[model samples]
Target chain A: MKTRRSDRLVDMTNYLLTQPRKLVSLTQFAKRYDSAKSSISEDLSILKRTFQERGIGLLETLPGAAGGARFIPYMLPEEAQTFINELVDEVNDETRVLPGGYVFLSDLLGRPEILKRVGRLLATQYINEDIDAVMTAATKGVPVAQAVAQELNVPFVIVRNDSKITEGPTMSVNYLTGSSKRVEKMELSRRSLPTGSRVLVVDDFMKAGGTIKGMMSLVGEFEGTVVGAAVFAEGRVSERVVAKYTSLIHVDTLSSDGTGITVTPGNYETEVYENNNLND
Target chain B: MKTRRSDRLVDMTNYLLTQPRKLVSLTQFAKRYDSAKSSISEDLSILKRTFQERGIGLLETLPGAAGGARFIPYMLPEEAQTFINELVDEVNDETRVLPGGYVFLSDLLGRPEILKRVGRLLATQYINEDIDAVMTAATKGVPVAQAVAQELNVPFVIVRNDSKITEGPTMSVNYLTGSSKRVEKMELSRRSLPTGSRVLVVDDFMKAGGTIKGMMSLVGEFEGTVVGAAVFAEGRVSERVVAKYTSLIHVDTLSSDGTGITVTPGNYETEVYENNNLND
Candidate 1:
């Protein structure tokens, strides 16, 4: 259809990134630059191939009837750190979150860039695992799980405090929320996962292993395997997990005066490799 | 190096999908199949091309040092429905969600299969929209955003109500949330988007377009253009914008009647034609 060979990819890539949350297929991109679809496909082929060379961005395309390619500008941790640092500055509002010991990021969980970067960093570590699915509890954890699930190229399932719209009946377990004052019930579709599926459970916070345990019980009911468990933040009873996993940041609220947060290996690409023997 | 026969693209594709999150170098896949990197590359070339042709999956390959190939398995709506329907049936908590006038889908959002299917379906329509990036508010919306991001090969950004430790500092805004009782503050980072960028915003709910307005404002602050905005469910007070969009399901909630939901055009793929319109 159309063609622009000289520096088309970089410009096209930039053009696509400038318009996040939309799609621009091969034919359209071809027509935009005045190149043939085959030639444009060649350009996309180069762009997509280059993505895996570095741990950033993905070029996805659909096939047949309504098919075209779109570019996802995913940032590697090195790239992600810049934004994370900026976000932390906003979170420095110590007074508002002091009562809870941390800012309630439940609201922030809905933002896209932060979650995309964070999720990729986590997924960059676990891409080779026998990860059957990404699991999380309601509200906050969904974003994190979705990011990781995307990075891992697997499915993500959510657990709930109660039955709500969008689902039928569920299999649930009691969980003592870390910051909240109640024993919340977490539920999953009994038939969603098959028997002996390998699952990785994740959440935004884990003060006690209570929520983790509850999810573990839910997994147990389905005869699924809890291959790993993780959290974006950990507080108070950090060491209470029934097993070991990863975390991007560790919130050690244990030592009364020294209550602080330190990032952990769980959040890094190294942990994913080490745990899955990826480096081997 | 490794390589398969001319038509063994499917096997190669599956082998890569089963591997998940790992970056498989050209040498690795080449060696596994006993083919030259060039030959493997050709196969991958075919795999990526044909995989999309079959509407089965995507192949993203990293070039140069520390690079490899990754396959993400996804399906269009027609294929995903039956599989997801079974899972939906298992989640048969019809009673609990009636109060919210919705099904309790907080958990299904986390399931990998459901997310994979839904994300792919929604992404098909926008795949050729020349989208720059994929945007979604946090929590439950993350997975949906991730699936779309992966399918489109773009970055997904998450906004927040309040910044967390993971995020250092942030750009803040007070937007009206869904149909909640009050207006909630939403936050994003200044550098998360490029000025004059085109962004697509996706979310799980759209009660009043309050938070969406805030996100639109956030896009404005970045000098970015909103290419489109969509939600999985309809909001309380709906207003049409330049790119106002809905999803597979629409939620209509009245003060007296409460909530009503229906499926929409978010499923079927958008038709894109080959611009064979050439010289006279």
Candidate 2:
């Protein structure tokens, strides 16, 4: 089946975008497009250059008998900073501050465009990590986990506060809710995360890092290692139980009256920027 | 700044894909690529032909002063059938049968690849409908709603079984659970969904579709209309509460001994295929 080069580029680009971080060998592209290996190689060079020039992602190509190309999703530091600033602005509204100092974020977290950008930014932080699966607590964390998991091309396991009959068998852990100090149970399907897997834990918000700590311990239950943890936003607390985690925003202050709320960009600069390979 | 056709195609494909269902005027492309309007038109023609030929989607081109192109996501009936069959097979195992005849599907729902494909398949059913938002119950339905909402380029609203303090104000409704015949409550945020919006409700599974019905009525509370409802799978029930909906698979039987299990394709063929504009 002969294919035009222009048509091939569009099809190939669509394929690569859908398959982030997955390696595709030249032979596979050659056979799919019914083009010569050399033509396929040339096309890849164009793709690699275009991807890098446009800051879409990095298209890493290997040359040899077992050579292939893989798409690693990345965001430029400037773009990430701009997006984070926009997020900080979006949540800085006084009306968003609910009772008990919780900020209303489901509206932002539920948007696909915002989730896609957040997913890419968070995924960039763990691009090279051996992430076998993404772990998150139920309800709020589902969207965040799904977004990052899709970018990394890995499955996500939902930790539910209450076990459902549909899950068959589950393992539960009791942890103290950071600010509330109430012991709550979180559970995961025993079959969701296999033993020895490397997991990335994420959530929509962190209040004293109780939920993130619960997820890490749950990962330990399955004998899986916690590669890293991240949250969309972190509210200021007296003492943080979980250390070494990435967050996109910090809710600095929230008066009991719901006014005087202040927001700032989280530690993404030092965590994501310095660790990112875009400059390299 | 001049741009090559090959590079432009790569960038344009990525942009169109990320902005599904969004109309992009030729002028915008021309300015972004620093190319002539005629060249941008030519590039879109190639993209349209390639996207259609590859069954990626439909690139609808409008001609004139207000002319532009929009990508409508679609899946070929053949592909949908193939995918639905795989889903049926994946869940047909006897071991999947849990106590109370529940089929364990968290592992499948947690998978990003499966979720993406399922999202596209479900979204294909309502490509031509005016969908303002996607709605689903908390926990299982979040991923499904996210997937379809992303394809439709719309935000999803999650209906929770219990109201959270962070949601500010919410409206709740009581519905009877189909199989169990127990009355349960479902709620949605007062502000997440605007009034008079068209909503598409989706879920991971359905027995009597009590949950879907609950969501539809909740939409009514917001003065929103439910344009459609869909599920990833439907299990056998003496009577289903929801009359009109699309599903990918039907689990006809699960013996009490967990030995005799049967699964088949749902009404998606008649619903999705007949309604699909792929041939056009």
Candidate 3:
């Protein structure tokens, strides 16, 4: 189809956005739009500059016969801070406190916009890890994992607490629940991950980190390496078994009367910002 | 931040893509990009044309003092057919058949790209519904519902088969399992949905339609209206309890001996394509 440069720019931007972190050859674009390679190159330069200025992401151009452009979506430090601060305020609501000292986060996690922001923030931290897949437990963590996987353009595997007949052959691991301190089993289908894959673990909330630890063990069983773990929120527990993880927000305190709650920004904000600057 | 039209177009495209089916005023974009309203309008015009030509979606501009634009992401008929045809071919593998005639689909459902395509096709069916939220049963259906909900820029609520304390106050209901013909219970947190919501139920697979029917009843209990229902794939059964629903693919024959399988594009492809053409 014949198209103007303006039209090509718009289409190219949308195309790159949908397939973040994936390289697309200019020849492919040239063939699809029936445009000259020079024109496609010009369009990429425009898109790359715009993406960087607007904090949308970095558009890296690979220069060679096998070269193309790749879109790596990331959040600027200011944008990440704004998102986390807003999330902190949202989670500070007293109504979100439950009977067992747990914060009722289903409503927040269910919102696509919030999940996307949180996903971007977490995915930004590990964007350069060459992550092959994202893994999370069923129920609460699916959206978070899905969001991260979407941004990274990878598959997400859910570890279920119960074995379903439909999953076929499965690998199960028992781990202690961080809060409950009870040994619980988590299972992932054997076919979900190939051996030696690098996987990132994501969850909505973390306290004792037992679930994350369990996922680490399961990853080991699949012969996959754990790139890292991240969460939307983490409670202020004196001890955590799973270390080396990033969280967007940290719940400092939750009142028993459900009248007050305190949350603060997580430690990863500064780390992410500093790391991003160094990369640039 | 001051930005050129090239930068604004890239950012605006990203913004509109992230929040599909939601209206954004020109003033908002102008303010965000530090651009003039006329400039923003011109940028959107370029985006709208490109989006349409590329089968990305529809960009409906509302003109007036209070008007702006709404991005409705949809698949063109040919694109939809291509996606469904490819999916059918993928799911027709004999190894997917399980002992109880179930098909293993977690791998496909877990892929972000496939989920995004499935979400777009399903969301296109209800683009005009003004759906308030998407709902699904826990486990296998969460990703599908989340995908559809993300496409619609809405929240998705998961109805869990087992009620957790973290969900707070929940309403539970019992429904007959289609395959096993056993009575099973599903529960949803009361806070998940506000009263009088219009919910679209989504699931990964459907057989007897019992689960979809249960979700419909659950929506009714929440004082919400069932806008419609959608599924990734459905098993061929002579009888279905739910009459009104759409499935992208139909599993015609799952050989008990695990020798052969027949899968076909769903009945909604033509309908979706026709409706999409009408809207365009």
Best-fitting candidate, scored by DockQ: 2
Candidate 3: segments with Cα more than 4 A from true spot: A64-66, A253-259, A274-280, B1-3, B64-66, B253-259, B274-280
Q: Each prediction's DockQ?
A: 0.13, 0.89, 0.83
Runs off by more than 4 Å, candidate 1: A1-135, A138-140, A143-200, A204-280, B2-49, B57-97, B100-104, B129-132, B162-165, B177-182, B189-197, B235-243, B251-280
Classify candidate 3 by CAPRI docking class: high
TM-score order, best first, reads 2, 3, 1
**Which one wins on lDDT?**
2
Considering the two chains of model 2, state its CAPRI-style docking category.
high
Residues B192-216, candidate 3: write the lDDT tens digits.
Answer: 8998999999899999899999999
Top TM-score hit: 2
TM-score of each: 0.53, 0.97, 0.95
Error of 1 at A68 (Å): 33
lDDT, candidate 2, A21-107, per-residue tens: 999998899889999888888888999999999989899899974787899998888889999999999999888888778788999
Q: Give me the overall lDDT of model 3.
A: 0.86
Per-residue CA lDDT of model 3 for A49-69, tens digit only, reads 888877888899987546689
- In terms of lDDT, the poorest run of 10 residues in model 1 chain B is B271-280
Q: Report how far residue B149 has shifted in candidate 1, in Å.
A: 1.4
